[model samples]
Target: VRAEAIITRESGGGRAFHALVSSDGRRIEADLLVLSCGVRPRTRLASDAGLRTSRGILVDDRLRSWSDPRIRAIGDVAHVADPRRYAHEREVPGGPAGLVGAGWRQAEWLAGALIAGEDPSPFAEDSPGIVLLKSRHVDLVQGGEIVPDPFAPGSGEVASWADPRHGTYVAMSTTNGVLDGFVAVGMPRAAAELSLLFQRRGELPSDRSLLLRLDAAEQPVRATGRDETVCICNAVTAGGIEDAVSDGCDTVDAVGCATRAGTGCGGCRARIAEMIDEWQGQHV
Candidate 1:
C-alpha cells in the first residue's frame, strides 16, 4: 500500500497540491493533507534595520535594542531580559515569552516611551511570565488567589484546559502573597489573564465569577482602564475595529482580510461581524 497527502487552499483559490500514489497496479489520490508546523524567532528584518539581533533582537530592560537608540521591538520579534530561575539557575530562552498579553504589555511601554520621548522600563520586570500549553489549550498565569496582592512573587499560578471532561490542573509557586510563575493545562484563557495580573501586580477581583463571565461571553464587555485586545493575532483592539469600520472595512470578511482580525481560529469572527453592522448602522 502507498500513501499520499494533499493540501487545500482557503477562499476561492484553485485546487492545489494534488498528490498521488500507486502500488499493486492501483493508484490513489488525496484531496487534503494537514501538517503541524513550528515557529522560530524571526529577526532578519530587525537586523536589516540596523538593530542588534541575537537569538532574537536583543533589547535592554526597557525593551529597547542596544544597537539602535530610537528603535524598539516587541512580541516574538524581540528578546527582552528573562527573569525566570528554573532549577535554581537563571535561564534565558532564545525568544521572549510569546503571548497576547506579553505583546500588549510591550506595546503599552513602547507607546509610553514614544509619547514621553524617553525609554520606559519593561512593564513586567519583577516577575517573569510563564506559558502553559497542553494539546490545543494555552494559558498565561501571573497571580494566584491571594488578597492585597495579585502577583506577589511566587503567588501567581497558570493552568491549562485540554479536556473539559477531566478536572483542570494548575501549577504555581508563590511567596509573600506574590505570584512567581506557574504551568497549567486545561485553562489557558484564565491563565493568560492571571499572568498579566501578576505582572502588573494589580489587584485581583474579589469575585472570580466576573472573570468567568468575561471569558465565557461571545462579545467583549467594556472595562475601565487598560484597553484589552479583542483580536490578538492582529493586535487590534475594540477601539481599533471601530476605527477601521469608520475608515471603511464595512464587513467581517473585509475587516478580516484587511486587518487579519478573524484570520486565526475564527473565534472572533462573529464579534467582528456584529461590530461592522453596528458601525454601518450608526454611520451609514
Candidate 2:
C-alpha cells in the first residue's frame, strides 16, 4: 500500500492531500478530503477595540497595540516581527520561533516594558535554528545559502538523520566560526539549551568535542519569566492564564473558556492540565 501526505504551498492558496492505504497493501484514491490543520488569528477584537490590524493586530516593541497603551498583545493575535538571519536581510513578521518559548519571551518583554514605563523593542533577531520535536531530524541552513537543495549533493551533510530508531538527530551549520542555523528533532530539551547557547555565544563551538559535550547534557529548556504566549492558535498564555486564575477561573476548561487556551487542536491539553494541577496543589 502507498500512503502519502502531499502539501501544496502557493501564493493564492495552500492544501494538503493525504492518501489512504488498504489492508491488502493497495493504494486507494480519496474523493472526499478531510483537513486537520489548526486555528488562525482572529483580529476582530483588536479591530473592534480600534487597534491597527493587518494579518494580525499590530504591536510595538512592548506588544502594545497601536491604539491602546493599556492593552498589550501576544501570541497569534499579535503581528510581531520575526527575527531574520544575517544571510537574509529581510524581516519576518508575527512572533519568534512560533513556539511556546517565543510567546513566553514576548510576554516577559511586554511585562517588563510596562512595569518600567518603557516600550518593548520589537524582536529583530533570527534564531540559530529551531528544533522540530517530531521527525527525528535536524535541518541546518545559513543566511545567503540559497535555501539548500533537498535532493542535491551534500544535502545529507546539511540534513542529518531522520531515523525513528535512536529518536535523535542534530543538524547545525556555522558561518565565519559562528553558528548560523540548526534543527534538531526529538530533542526538545537539547534544542532549547542549544538555542540559548547560540544566542549567548553568537558563535558556534570550534571544538567538536565541546559541541558534543554540550549536546550530552540532560537538562531540558525551561520557560523563562518573560514568555508571552503559550498557546498560539487561541492566543492564550501563561500570564494570561494566571490572570484568569486570579480572577477565579481555576479549571482547565474554565481557563480555556476564559482565556481561550487549548481550544484549538488540544495539543496543549497536557500542559494546561499540568498548570491546573500545579495551581490546585499550591492553592488547595
Candidate 3:
C-alpha cells in the first residue's frame, strides 16, 4: 500500500526488550523512551454519545449539537458552525473547535450564551492565529493570511526587512490598505505589535515601509484606542490593563490574575509585561 509502513515485530515484556522495524530500514529498540508526533481530535466519546461528526463532533453557531441542542461542543474535538452566510466559516480540519485562542473565545461566548443568554455570533475563519515558536535562540511570530503576495498590485501590498546578524526577518502583508498578515522572525517587538494589529483588524499605516522599522509601531499602536483588544482570548484591552494597574495590579501575574491579559496563548504576555513596565516607569 502507498504511504503505508508496517511494524513487523514488537516485544516489550519480561526483561523489557522491544525491537521494531519500518519499511524504510529504520530499527528501534526500546521499553518506551518516547514517541512524539502531531496530535488529532479525540472524537470517540462524542461519537459514542451519538452526536454528529464531520472529522469531529459537529455543532451549530451556538455550539449546540444538531442531534442534541442541550449538548454544546468545544475545543480540539469539536466541529463548530458559523451560522451567518457572510462568515464563510465552517467545520475546519482538526476541530470541532481548534486553537487555544479560538477555543477560549468559544468558551467565553458560550459562557455568555449560557449565563447571560447572549446570542452567539459568526466566527471569522480567516482571522489570524498568533504563533510564537518556543525554542532557544529562535523567535518567530506569524499571523493572518500571508499568501498570494499582497503586494502584487491586485491584492494589496507587501513590505519586509531583514537583519542577518541578529537573525531577524520581518514581512508584512496588506490587502487594499488594511493589514492582512505578517511574519516576524527574531524581531520580538515587531512580532508583538503585529500580532495586536492583526487581531484588531486595523488598517496599515499610510507609510507601509514603517512596518519594517522598529520605532514605527509604538505611537501608532498607542493610538489604537482602549476599546481595541490586546488579548482576544480573555477580552483584555489596553485600557483594561491600565485600569488594572491603576487599581494596584502592578505585575504581569497580578494583571493576569485580575484581568487575564497574558494567560491564554501567551502571545500577549510580552506586550502585557511591556505595558506594566511602561506604566511603572511613568509613575516612578
Reference-based TM-score, model 1 = 0.43
lDDT of each: 0.55, 0.52, 0.66
CA deviation > 4 Å runs, candidate 3: 1-39, 82-97, 116-128, 134-138, 148-156, 215-235, 265-270
Write the number of the candidate with greater lDDT, choosing between 2 and 3.
Answer: 3
Give per-residue lDDT, candidate 1, residue 277.
Answer: 74
C-alpha lDDT (0 to 100) for residue 158 of candidate 2? 39
TM-score of 2: 0.46
Error of 2 at 41 (Å): 1.9
Ranked by TM-score, top first: 3, 2, 1
For candidate 3, the lDDT comes to 0.66
| Tens digits of lDDT, candidate 3, 111-194 | 777786656564334355665554445667777656546446554577777777877788888777677778888765566567
Model 3: colliding residue pairs: 78-95, 78-96, 78-97, 79-96, 150-157, 151-157
Tell me the tens digit of each residue's lDDT in model 2 across 129-235. 23222111332212223225445654332333444585565556555655555655554333444455555546655653344334445632222222334454444
Best by TM-score: 3
Against the hidden reference, what TM-scores do the models get?
A: 0.43, 0.46, 0.68
Q: How far off is residue 225 in model 3, in Å?
A: 5.9
Number of clashes found in candidate 1: 30
